[model samples]
Target chain A: MTELYQKQRAMRAMRKAAMQRGVIAVLDVGTTKISCLILRFDGVNLNDEGEGVGSISGHSGFSVIGSATTASRGVGFGEVLSMRESERAIRTALQSAQKLANIRVDHVIACFSGGKPRSYGLAGETTVQNQVVAEQDIARVLSACDVPDYGDGREVLHAQPVNFALDDRSGLADPRGQLGERISTDVHMLTVDEKVIRDLAHCVKRCDLELAGVASSSYASAVSSLVEDEQELGAACIDIGGGSTGVSVFLKKHMIYCDSVRLGGEHITRDVSMGLQVPIASAERIKTINGGLLATGMDDRDMIEVLGETGDWEHDRRLVSRTELIGIMRPRVEEILEEVRSHLDAAGFEHLPSQQIVLTGGSSLIPGLDGLASRILGQQVRLGRPLRIHRLPQAYSGPTCSSIVGLSLFAAHPQDEWWDFEMQSDGYPTRSLKRAVRWFKENW
Target chain B: MSQINPDRYTRSDPAPSLWSYRLLRLMLSPYLRRMVFYGIPALFLVGVGVINITNEQRREQVLTTYSEMKTFVTERPEFTVNLMSLKGASDSVMQDIREVVPIDFPISKFDLDLDQMRQIILGLGPVKDVDVRVRSSGVLQVDVVERLPAFLWRRDDGLEVLDATGIYVRTVTSRLQYSNLPLIAGEGADTQVAQAKQIFVAAKPLKERLRGLVFIGERRWDVVLDKGQRLMLPEEDPVLALERVIAMDQAEDLLTRSVKAVDFRLQNRPTLQLRSGAMEAFREIKLMQLGQIK
Candidate 1:
């Protein structure tokens, strides 16, 4: 737990240093594509710097001055499988984007989608030292949370204080300067397998750059895809990417739960290639052009060519009805949606005030996905697009770039983590039993 | 009207119709759908290709014929800023602006940066703010908001006119130009025009004997008189207590007597320093009163 706290503090310090230097790059390392967005800070507006996005300040105002994407190589299921191949791909994307922006950036905030994310909601409370809950008390209460030994091979990725309560009053966003006898806090902690992070850090170091910050791709996706009201009330953003589907639940503009599934669009592509007896490239093209779930009588007559390998002439070309193509794609798409539904159920997503599901990502562009998702997930679903920013290229403004753009937003104005609050070392006890007992009493 | 219920009509379950299903499938079929998606872009590419092949020869043919007309249109005087004009400015400040910002006429308005010209015009001393714009009629319009003179400040260097915000409006070669405004004299008096103005308004009753107000150390005021009397005012609420002094003078004719100076820095004990003759008379009267009492 102390190591986890120290790592969070180190990341915060790096983020502050990177922000003060002005320009930072955001890299979204996905299984299918690696995207880089160079963000010029332009110095924050002094009057309203700390206020969250959707205003004229924060990361939403940053322009994607330089953006370049390359086909990902040596990445499988959103983790780096080969260091050399991934490093080369990262360098190509960063160099081309930096060349376009005409400024070299050394600090980068990277996001990844793998390592099996798990979420926990922990609460702790502390007495108000001076009758009024000051910032120090808030920090002490947050530090006082008993971080259950979340296994040996895992590390904390995001720990956010989602809600605060002062004595009998609950749902307090900020309790400082208020008179209260006790201050209670609920912090949402997301941990991932540590080996995946070490691999990513090594790959980044090989590219001759410093990793200023790290964020979960699922959390970043929700930040970009969900509308302000949807996030404030409560909604789930399911980012269906190439090799994985990321599920994140945001409430009060904070990510309270996040999980990732191993199945994604590439599996469906594999299914199409194997079912239609065609190459993977041809399968990808045909799926993107002609894939859907709902088919009817007229689709039985509509035929599409299954382009084959060039070696054999007679077997090189074949024709299949659109209904057959839908027959192969529908089951797989439904399987993915069902898996997402189960993950949502496991996260207690139904208890949220609003259960609107927003589907975003490259694979989410499949026609009739929202209708199918509604049937399975049983929520008011809508196709999510990244909130429009100034000067963003029309090409990169689609659902595929949601995670990267959200990473850019996260880089500019990170949410207030536990480390942001100032803690007094002299007065704070080092893991006392009385505080743990108090936490259990207040939370349970 | 047959005992209708809205729930029956609004039910989510719609009876599956075969004809609508066939229609939806017809629209959703890949062959027709791909054409619906890629047809426009295919047609656009073909159109662009044909145009590109024909445009080279078309440009060669037409460019030779239209060269003279192109030159004639580009050289038109209406498209250029030929006759420049300045509005809403006095003659002298306008002349100063024109001299500082030298412009070559018969130039294209696209080449002119209006913001730079606005900054140049605003740099003039009396010009508080200015707006430089180009009219569609081809005349350059310069709208000026000149700072008005608020007070006449007499200093060791020279007399100058100060604006309401204590900014120097213009230098006065002679005091007669702004004699109607209240005159202030001292070092740093131009920075305290608002305070000096308040004191002058309070001393309006002593207008005839009032010479001018002198600012002391840029903190307080000294009301000078034509008969060489001075009133030292307190730093805080000087104007209100000056009004009180004016009321006292109106009641007792204090200014007409042998008072050299009045000090009101102390709110409770306002001391009037009398002249030598009055001081000696006061001491003799005090001594005679003491002997009588013994």
Candidate 2:
């Protein structure tokens, strides 16, 4: 019995050590670009020396050994538009990163950005069989979650037992071996588009990479953007991208719900393109330079030069007041915010303990955007940048890098799944948790 | 002019139809015969329908029962247990449970408890743990985690095993197979079980270094080293106090040479109490040791 117990502990220690040294590859399949980073870890030893002394901590190796990114093709609104083009793009990125790291990368975890995401809070209860809820009972309650029929083409991306309740008692973190009359559990199920999930998986497979896991882009963004306190309490992460805006709600360090709006920075660019009568590329530049939500003191006397595509040098001139630019930018941004508000409302955002809103992405960099968003959101709104990384290239450290940086962290410290619990049936005498009922009786 | 009874008008009553044939003859005509003939068959059909429906329900129940039995036969544990004795436990309680239960095997395989089972068995001097669990179908499962026979502590209430946790495992026979353990007997031994548990947990790293532990007061503990000696420990912050003992082991060849006991019941420094009960040796453990506690 002692030998059996000792062997079990030894195996667990070995598994934890093995995970620290393995190579992990991340695939970020966005509409604009497909980035891949192949990281070779030196194992997770708590006594590593660096500037990352106390800031970013734990077993996900804080060592950055390799990274890579490439422009995306044949992808639209977060799904692969053409399999061949997307496959080629992924191969290019992976090969480029592998070249830099001087290593062969095989396994990959990809983050998806599209799908009409909805949140459902389901709860289930069962009686304690042995006068207590043991580990088996916990597994039973989670399995009894009816295996929600998330349509024919969809697959369950995440099914987590968020909170547990014992009889009339609430706020139980770990209900294992605890006694009560009835044990109830709150399960949060997240589903993704089957076609999208499968196609991305196929793309990775085509690139000769095993699909280790899949996470939502919005969820990955929240990981790097939201701080530890925000994650512990609750916060909404809004990432406005090139072709769409993704919204994710997090509490207790896990994403409870995620959604996306099809309108993004491109819409704002299009609005400027029409208002200033310039090329689409020129409108983007002008928007970056002159876009603002507030235009109170701006003078009509201030003029802006516009470059048209007429090809005649004399005709390539136009002027517009700052007020006109504000008029064009304000409505589109407000429309995007309005759509995001409905998304938050529908996901039951009010149930969260904290109502802080952290906005990220390239579109969030507009001047006076926070005040406008705060007015529209009716909550504390602040621009967010991904935290917890060292010696980050200056060009890659911004709101836009939230998902990529978060992907790095997520790959490093993936949570232990159900199989991590040891349920060995050997020579040791296994005792039932019947006496746990004494706790309830004593408290009553 | 009383209205005829429904039963008297109907053929369901033989008395109304058999003797009063003349009156029934008129009622037995085509119009009346149609009602009588069809009504009887319809009643019979209803009866037959109910019988068939009930038979089908019974068959379904049998099928479900067979399915469950198949699963149990395949999944239930195949345990090897020998029945030692049945004494204090009530046979009627076992009988009432066995009426609906399908344990399918003989009861002689498992040990049965009887008599004042709780007091007697719990009073065992050697046994350490008792765990009991009940299944949903009313089957009781009992597991006993026993301790090695050590010492008999005489207390006012009774004798009990001073386990690693310092709690009473049980108390009964003092003489048993387990040896190489020191014994301590005194008044107020019941209060030392929890302290003993702390000592066992704290001295995990010093496995071979430990010989035996004795209760000094209930709040204090006396630890005997491998060479047959003792160290008295104080109640307050005993962990730090044990660290001091570890330091002495390094400064002096404390664990290497033979000595009786070291008393640290006082906070300042450890005092030695020499009495070579099991091993023979030395003056003061000449300090020079420089090995880790592991």
Candidate 3:
């Protein structure tokens, strides 16, 4: 645990250094595509204290200088399957983006939607040594949380303090300098397979980039796709990616739970290919053009030609009705949404005040996905596009680029994680001189 | 279906090779890009130049070419001096100046050293100051201020004309050539030309009788008259002494009384040394007055 804390701290420090450099690249290594967006931080904070949504949703601090996307290779379920191929794919996207920006980016904040994330909610309480709560008291309360055994070969990706409670009163956002006898906090910790992180880091390192920070694509997409009120009132963002569908639950502007399903739009494409006896590429094209969750009578007449390069003229000229194509795609998409529904239910998402579900990512572009999602997830289901950022091209303004856009926002403004705070001195191996001085000051 | 088939055939691998990716990144780096696009070429050109110039023959060739180019610009007709115009000097003094400042016509002004040439011209006796410049009309104008000969000093070698400040101007062959100029003779007399001229002014009443003033011991002046009589004046106020001598001579006709010389070297005393005949006549007058040798 301490090793992971040190590693996360190092990454946080690197992120701060990248922010200091004023140029950072946000790479979303998705199953279907690798998208890179180079953000140039102008060091301007548009949203000051209490300035609500100051400029472009508080994104005036950075501008998207360059953006590029390339078809992913050797990546499945948002995990790097082949190191060499993924490295090359990353290189391709980053090189093109750097070419567009006319600058070199060294630090990258990457996100992936694989690794089978598990969320844990921890509660800890401690008696405040002073009448008013201090930063140390908060740290002590946070350190008092009992970390659960997330099992071997899994690493804690994010551990964020979600709520602070003072004595009988609860849900205090901050308890510092408040009259409280006892301070307690609720922390949300998400863990993923360690091998996935190592592989992604290796790929990024192979591309000559420093991995400044790594985030789950589900959390990143939630950051961009969920509206401010939706995040505050509690909402769930379902990112239907190529190889995975990422589900993240946000409440009070914080992500409490996130998980990803192995099934995604790529499964639908594969289903289409097998059902129509066509090539994977043609099936992808057919699914994009004709794919719908709710089939109509008119869809039965609309035929999509499935092309093949098998050197047989008859085989290359095959046609499939849109309804038939939808018949092939809808079940896989439904399976993915059903898998997300189970994860949301397990997270107790139905208990939240607002069960608003936002459907985003590349697969969310299918027509009639929201109508079908509203039936399965909840009535508040809606298709979400990423928030508008400065200098983003029109082509990247679709639901497909949500994770990458969200990763840019994550790079600009990262949430405070467990490693961001000073660890309680009791967790230290050696006696602290500061603790000794504090003891003398309090007692003397 | 047709569109998908074409894309399958034309779908090139978009991933760059590892080496190509690294090279592209290196090229995108601002420092390395500037080095490749601007620095390397500049350094290459400078290195080639340095290598070429390192050879002795090439170095000599380059130097010669540079100097030839320089002369090509300097030798233009507008910059060339075709003639020298002498001004504010007499013919003889101008001839002396031309002799001292030897230069060939049609030479470039850049090749001429005016200051050195001015110094050489100033070495001539009559030139007090000189200004040398090359005019725009291809003329080297030399303006000379010649010293005026104020007195003729008769030295052991010959008589030389001296200016008012006692600087030698020229040599004179005969005294009559500058008869209006007073003659001064003796060692170091040229240094006292100013005082001698002042004494001459003081002795203006006896100008017809005065022959010249001689610098006796480099300290005092002796006024010589045509009758072989001399007035030895004191050094401190020689002009005043001479003035007093002239006043006495005017009142008593003392200079025509057969006196050989008047001595006024001391301010409190005046003396006269008479000629032999004048002394014998003075004694016979005394004997007639005393009835001793009638």
Considering every candidate listed, which one attains the maximal TM-score? 3
Native A-B contact fraction in model 1: 0.00
lDDT of all predictions = 0.83, 0.66, 0.88
Native-referenced DockQ of model 2:
0.00
| lDDT agreement of model 3 with the native | 0.88
TM-score of 3: 0.66
Q: How close is candidate 2 to the true structure, as a TM-score?
A: 0.52
Two-chain DockQ for each candidate model:
0.01, 0.00, 0.32
Q: Candidate 2's residue-wise lDDT over B23-62, tens digit each? A: 3333434555666779878988998767756797876877
Over 4 Å off in model 2, which ranges? A1-21, A44-59, A299-302, A312-315, A416-444, B1-294
TM-score of model 2's chain A: 0.82
lDDT of 2 at A111: 83
Q: Compose the digit string of candidate 1's lDDT tens values, residues A329-394.
A: 989999999999999999998999999999999999988899899999985999998877657789
> By TM-score, highest first, what's the ranking?
3, 1, 2
Arrange candidates, best lDDT first.
Answer: 3, 1, 2
Candidate 1 wrongly placed segments (more than 4 Å): A45-60, A428-444, B1-294
Of the native A-B interface contacts, what share survives in model 3?
0.73
| Clashing pairs in model 3, backbone N/Cα/C closer than 3 A | none
TM-score of each: 0.57, 0.52, 0.66
Share of reference contacts kept by candidate 2: 0.00
lDDT (10s digit) by residue, model 1, range B176-209: 9888888888888877788888898889899998
